[model samples]
Structure formats: C-alpha cells, structure tokens
Target: MAHWDPRGQVAPHVRRQVASLAAAVDELVVVSTADLDDDGAAFLGRHGRLLRRTNYGYDFFSYKTGLEASRPEDFDEVVVCNDTYVPLVGYGEVFEAMAGRPADFWGLTASQRVHPHVQSFFVAFRPWLVGSQAFRGFWGRMSPVSDRASVIAEYEVGLSRTLTDGGFRFASYYTETDADRALAQRRVAWWTLHRLPPPRRRREWEFLKARSKDPWNPAIALADVALAPSPPRPAGARLPYLKIDTLRYDPYGLGAERLLRLAERRRPEELAGVREYLAATAPLSAARPDTDLRPTPVGVRPLRRLVEYGRAA
Candidate 1:
C-alpha cells in the first residue's frame, strides 16, 4: 500500500486501512512520502516493511520505489492501492469474491471515460501478470509526472492497455450491468446540471455546455459509481471503497456525501475514525484553485518493449 499525507500525520482511518490490508497479504510494504510520528512508524513497522521517499512523485512514484525495493517477482499476487479512498467493506469478502474470478488482473472498479480501463486506486495483479516481462517494463517506464492528465494518459490508462495488448485478460470486481451503466449515465447528467453555479449563471453555463464541450472534465466524464452511489445500490454494486478525493475535491458535487452517508447507514462501526479524519481535514472546499507548481520528479510512464525500455531505464 502507498500512503501520503501532506501534513505527515496518520489518521485513524488510514491506520486502520493499512493494518487491515496488512493482514490479507503475506507481506505489505508501505512507501510513505511524508514523515510519520513514532507511533505511526511503530504501527507500520509491526504491520509491514516501511520505506520513506521524497514527496516529489505521485502515488506511482511510491509504487515504483516500493515495487523495486520489495522485489515483487516472488509474490503470488501484487496489489497496488493507495490512501486516496476509504474502504467501506473489509478485504475478506472482496478477496474471497474475487478469488474465483478468472481475471489475470483486476480492480475494484473500471471506468470508461476515454476508454475502458481500471481505476488505479485498487488494482490487484495475479501471478500471471505480475511475473511477466511486461510488468517489469511497466514499472521501469514509469516517470512520475507532476500533472494529473499526463499521469492518467500514460500510467493509469497505459497500464491496462499495455497488459491487454500483451494478451492478458483483466476484470473489474463490481462489474456494472447494462442497467447500472444506464443509471450512471443518467446520474452523471443530473450531477452535471446540479453542480452549476447559482441560477442566472447556471442558465448561461447550461446553454454553453449544451453547445460546447471545452470544459468537459475527467471527473465529470468518468462516471464511476463511487461518485454516484445514492439511494438503492444496483445489483452487483459491491464496490468496497468510497474515494477520499470525492470527499474533498468533489468538483461535480455529485453525492460524495450520499456515498458517505450510505456507508454510515450500512456500517457505522467502521466510520468513527473516518469521521474524525474528516473533522481534522475540514473538507470545506469543493474545488481547489490552480496553484503554481514546479516540475517534480513525479511524471509520466509510457509503455515500451522490454529490451528498449530496459536500456532507457
């Protein structure tokens, strides 16, 4: 598991997540970008191998560092997940459910924004995919780009495409049926309409959007059900996580609260620490202003032949 907090403090929910995940795997390696307190360090130490890296790259940077350091070739399965979400359900059911599935690799959910690909947050690699030359080359090609778009295009989307092109099959755990997908499309439209600015401007914004697609956003276009798990869950809608990003940066205002509320209603026992973390973080802003950023080591990763990429790396 890869975890990073800007303030270098570990929240109770995060700790619980890490510990809970630790129990499932034979070994868990946590690559932390931020410094941890003594208790945090001790807790992680008890759970798994803990490595510290400079906070220059994104999650994938930690991914590269951790994978290289741990030597994942020996493992039967390798799961790359991060602190970007809170898992509403524990891993036991999820793992058990997915065990019989025939996918060489799988994720909790998949999105069809630009194309079909698994969301990067919770991907599990079976030994078939994990031990391949493609797997090693994938990591070697990774350059933790500073921007989200490039990262998505290169690493996130590139991952599934690369593996698929290599003849490996992938699957999503909570596979949405045709009806569920239609519901998501409708929900997405509702969210886009409601997330508009106040009345007069909302009219203008609606008019503009009706004609132009310039402001079409990744989050908006990517209609994952985590962003819209309101009311009745569709059949087979057993996604384990509710993204923390949706809690803070819900650009569409598309029912992140409803998702949280649903989790609370279903399983309040697991939510106390999540609530505490939310209180500490104070998720008041829906969107963040574009801050001037420096070019960091965290960048992009593109797919390439093993031999060529090997020399480049």
Candidate 2:
C-alpha cells in the first residue's frame, strides 16, 4: 500500500517509485489524498489500484482505508509505504531479508527518540499481525488529524506502544545500538548549532532534546545510514546529516543518482520509467550555501562545543 497526494499532476518520480514497488509486490494499492490527474491515473492504471479520497487525515487515514479495502486472509504479507523515498539499491533484497526474520511487524528502520517504533515509511505486517484484534483496534482508535505533530504523537509513536502492549512483537531492519545513540546526540548538537536559525534554534533544540535523549534526529539518521555504501552500517554510524527540506536542500542527488546508477547496471528494465523523472527533477543547484553557519548562542556554545568534540573524537 502507498499513500500519495497528487498535489496537482503526480510527478514522474512518484510514478516511478509506485511502479518500482508494484514490481516487488503481489498487489499494489494506492490511496491518494486527492484525485489523480489524467497522467497520474493512467500511469497507476497500468500498475495497480488507485483510490481517491478527501485529504483529511494524512497517511494514517490512507493506511486505514487501504487496509480496510484488503482482506487479511487473502495475502501472506502486506506492506505500507509512502512516496517520500526512492529505493536506490536493493529494494527486493530488503524485503527478502525481512521475510526470513520472525516478527509480527517490521519496518526498514526503527526510532527510539521518544519511544521505540518502527518507522512507518515502509513497514510490513504478516497475516498474523494483520488479523490481530490489536491491529484492527489501533486503526479503530484513530481520529481525523491534519497536523503532522499530532500524527507523529498519536499514530507513529502510539502504534508501537499499542501493539507491544497487545503482545505483538516488532523488529526493524536497522537495530538501535549504543554507538547509534552516541552519534545521534552529537549530530543533534551539530544540527542545532549549525543548521538552524536564531529564533527557531532554541525551540528546535528543546524539542530535539525532549523527543530524543540521543543527539541525532532519527529520520535524518535513517537517510544517512540507508544511503551509505555497500555493507551498510547501523543508523548514525558515519553518515553526515542530509538536510531534508525538500528542494531547498538535498545532497546534490547523490543518493538518488547512486540508486539510478545501480538500477542501470543491474536492473536496466526497472530504470525505464524513472529516467525521464530523474532527468527532469535533478537538483537545480549544488548543496545549499553554508554562509549561514554560526556559533551557538552564549549560553549554549559550551555545550555545543562539548558535543562537537565528542563527535570528532
């Protein structure tokens, strides 16, 4: 299952991602937040089912709708993912690896910032989990929410706790480690001091501290580790923070380009639809200018320096 917002016309990149996922799964169901444009509808028609709905509750609602449309007994496993990521490397291999793992539910990554939960971006639930009363109950408890923070708190964080309390087990492709926590903390400091602005920095810093005891942000850390070279290390290994402000800053298309090259070399057929998309959406500039880098505020500078030293060491 994939949740999308056509926005206007669905980008070629999104279509390509959907097509890639379609190739990997037995059935592909797309729940769109808005009606698809003709091109979007036509492209998805070739790949899978596309259902349009009001953009009310965000991905969680779309996820519920998709689950409602499918019967648990009909499929051995079901995956729910959103279109924020492009599978650059072994999309198949990741699933194959998870298939051998014995867990009721699993995702490509996990976060332990506030509470441990499998990041919902690409999670797979076995039929056992899918059919569980707990599973159904979780969705049943959902209320319509358009706020990102509310979704994160009530759904993303709440889901893991709900399921675990119900005696359902979970796992992640990337496990949490002490090293990961240590590195994450350092990165958090770096991001707060160097990346954010004066007015917002303190607030973001406090939020980061409250949500994560560690230094690094989980989402940013996940991207860093997942996109690393072969023999990938755990999240927050050596991967630098990649600012994820959509088009405002990206890593010069390094991750996507790497994936494209890998696809061209090994899965040429899979590269067809994405070629035009990648060409059209290539990053228009180099990395965002770093002229804004500044020292932390007087009260915070010493603490920031301590973290910077720890990261360096």
Candidate 3:
C-alpha cells in the first residue's frame, strides 16, 4: 500500500488495516513518503519491506516505486492502493470477489463523470495485463511533477485509456447505481445548502442540525460527482470500504455519524478502528487557517547535505 502520514507515524486504524490485509496477499509492500520514525518503520517492516521515498508525484509514484522494487511481473496479480480509505471488512472477501470477476484489471469502484474509468485509489491488475507492453509503456513514461491535476490526468486516468486501447479490459468492484447518484447528489446538496466549509469533527455537526436538509442545491447537484460513495441510508448498504475522503473532506456529506451507525449495526468488528480514524482526523472547527504561508528557508543549508528522491517519479 502507498502510505503517507504528516506525523511520520502510522495511525492506529492503519496499523489494524495493514495487519488484516496482510493475510489476503502473498506479499505486502508499504511505500511511504513520510520519514517514518523507528517504531513506525519497525512495525511496518514486520509485515514486509518498507520503503521511504520523497513525496513527489503523490501516491502514484509511491505505487511506482513499490512495483519497481518488488518485481510485479513475478506475481499473478498486483494491487496498487493508497491509505486513502479504511476497509471495513477484511480484504479476504474483497480479493475473493475480484478473483471470480472476468476483467484484466478491477478497482473498488468506477466513475462515469470523467469518461468511463475506474477510480485509481484501489486497483488490481491481472498478470496477463501486467506483462503486456501497454502496462510497461505507461509506467515507463511516468515523470515526477508536484501538480496533482497533471498526475491524475496523465497517469490515473491515462492508465485505463492506455490499457483499454491495448485490448485489455478493466472493472470495478463497487458499481454505483442511479439510486447512488440520487443519494450522492443529495448528500452534496445537503452540505451545499448548509454551505459547510471543510469539516474537522462531529462537534461542528451542530450546524447540520440547525441548517436546512432540503437537498435541492441545483448547481452543486449538477457539478461532477466527487467520485466518493454515498452514506448508507437504510444503514446496511454495501460499501466495501469507507473512503477517507468522505470523512476527512466530507465532500459527499458522508460523516462519522452515518459510518458509526453502520458499524454499530452490523460491522462492530471494525468499530474501534473506525472510531480512532474518525477522532484523529476530525477537526475541532471548520474555520480556515489564518497563517498557512511559510517563510522560505535561510541560505538553503541543511548541514551541507541535500536529499532528493522521486526525480524519476
């Protein structure tokens, strides 16, 4: 898994997540951009090889680095995922389901908004497709750039286009429905009507109660779906993983309360991990920061040493 943490330490939820996922794969490789501390590195090292790289091209480069070091061609299937979501169930079931499907590549979910493509957050590629020239050529051209938009456009979405043109097919595990669209749009609209800024935690949820629940923000509803899963309405809907984007960014109005409800109802096994993740990310306020800009370093001196990584990202 491609991993990053500002604290240079693994979160409790991620530790549990990695441990559970370890059983589903023959090998586990964690590529981290963060300069992990000794305990963090040792914990991850226990599972499999742990690599540290510069945070250059975001998660895709981390995926690239891991694949290069691990010899992906030797494996029957290779999965590229980031720590962007927390799987509520064990990956054994997810792998079991994907193995029965008939696609060269498959992901957790796909989106139709920006051409027909699988969201690249979590994708598994079959060996046949992985060995093809199209697969190699795509990665061969990857370059390190800080701008995320270009990475998504050229690599994330580009990979699907390249593979598809080469006669390889791709699929998604969680296919969204018209009902999901209605629900996602409604979710966006609810937050839009309330006009909530970036949310930090459940304490700010008081605004949700005080705000309108009309779900009729036409402009936002018409905006492209943010490629996130909607919250469970009936409360037991099948979402294989709870997207961290939904909770941390709240782009889809899928917050802690809905997730807690789902976990409390059916998947209590993951309740503790889910709670820790939520509390860690949940901010005390949605208020914007007053001083985000930082002053440049003096003389560009770091003890006469320079560390540059991901130059080929």
- Among these predictions, the greatest lDDT belongs to 1
What lDDT would each prediction earn against the true structure?
0.66, 0.62, 0.64
* Candidate 3 TM-score, C-alpha based: 0.71
Task: Residues 251-285, candidate 2: write the lDDT tens digits.
Answer: 11223344344445544543455565444444532
lDDT of 1 by residue, 1-313 (tens): 7877755677777887898898888889998987777877788878999999997667888888888898677888889988877776568668877887888998888776666788898889998788888887888877768777777888888888888888888887775646554444444444444444333687786773663332223222232443343433543356566666655545444434554565566556656577667766664322454321222212211211111101110
Candidate 2 global TM-score = 0.71
Clashes of 2: 4
lDDT of 3 by residue, 1-313 (tens): 9998776878776887789868789999999998799999999999878988987898989988998998898898999988776676468777777787889998877665445666787889999888999999888888887665677677777888888999988877664457545655445434433355533678666664444343332112221222123453222223466555444443433333544454445545554565665566456323323212223235422311211111100
Clash totals, every prediction: 6, 4, 4
TM-score of every candidate: 0.77, 0.71, 0.71
Ranking by TM-score: 1, 3, 2
Rank by lDDT, descending?
1, 3, 2
Model 3: how large is the Cα RMSD against the reference? 13.9
Candidate 2: what lDDT? 0.62
